[model samples]
Target: MKNTLKISAITFIFSIGVLAQEIVDETLNTQVDANIPGVVAQKEIDNLDDQAKKLYYEFKDTVSEYEGLKRYDDQLEKIVFSQEDEIRDIIRQIDSLDNVNKEILPFLKETVDSLRKFVNLDMPFLKESRIARIDDLDSIILQSNVTTAEKFRKVFEAYQLEAALVIPLKHTRIYRA
Candidate 1:
């Protein structure tokens, strides 16, 4: 009995489906008739509109970036122009530095030599060490690695040490007797 009922239900559903085909669209050809010249599907129109919107936004972003680049270029030009005087001043300083370096080398050499002669002729306290220091200074001045400024600084420090040695630290001598 149950099998008979199931067969009847299937037959009824099949008959209804066959009759319902006339109500629905026959094929995709009827959905877009060949006779129409410019008719397109609603889904295609929606997709085209979306693509157009995306392109429009991209173009807007590109234009904004171009304007930003234009501003940056203008600012860069201004900075270059503003720095011209400073650049010239720095260049002059550098040129003068080279001249000073040339003039000072001979003076430094003479000073070092004079100090060496004085130390040799004077009383012999730490004499060898003093001569070694002068020798080191001579090598430092001649070295390509040491800058003129650094050599000058070293010479000044040596002069300070010599001055301290010559000058007494106290005016009154300590009488511990």
Candidate 2:
């Protein structure tokens, strides 16, 4: 009887220990199940924070680039305005030159006519050559290919040649011994 009672007590103790171990295991599983959603939520929050930081840096870089481009555009505008002013000044100079060119030809013709009259009235020194030079001037004036500046230069050169021929002859009385 004593041996049977001891065996029954031993079996009841072993069954209680197993029941306690099962209860502990069930509590731990429930706790792990309850915490899963919180862990998942923390991971999602960390990912979103990283993305926000990346987007903020990108925004900053974009803003910086826009400012730089705006400054460049303003500089270009100033340069364009300056170039437009220079173009207007050059146009005015060209217009004034056009007026001068229109008036010069008639004036040159009168001057050449006056020079021819003077040469004809002067002393007959170098007569044929001076006449030939005047004739050359007439032909140069009528030619289509010659520029007005060149024609004027030729006339000035002829006037210089005539001036060079005017030398004062020295008057000396011969004393007879």
lDDT per residue as tens, model 1, 52-142? 9999999999999999999999999999988997899999999999999999998899989988997888667688888999999899989
TM-score of 2: 0.61
Report the Cα lDDT for candidate 1.
0.85
Clashing pairs in 1: none
User: How many steric clashes between backbone atoms does each model show?
Assistant: 0, 0
Query: What ranges in model 1 sit over 4 Å off?
Result: 1-55, 79-89, 169-177
What does candidate 2's lDDT look like per residue over 1-177, in tens digits? Answer: 999999999999999999999999999999999899989999999999999999999999999999999999999999999999999999998898778767877777777788789788876767889889988988888887998789889988988877776543124344679
Question: After aligning candidate 1 to the native by TM-score, how far in Å is the CA of 108 from where it should be?
Answer: 0.8
Candidate 2, residue 35: Cα displacement in angstroms equals 4.0
Cα-based TM-score, every candidate: 0.57, 0.61
Off by over 4 Å in 2: 1-9, 111-177
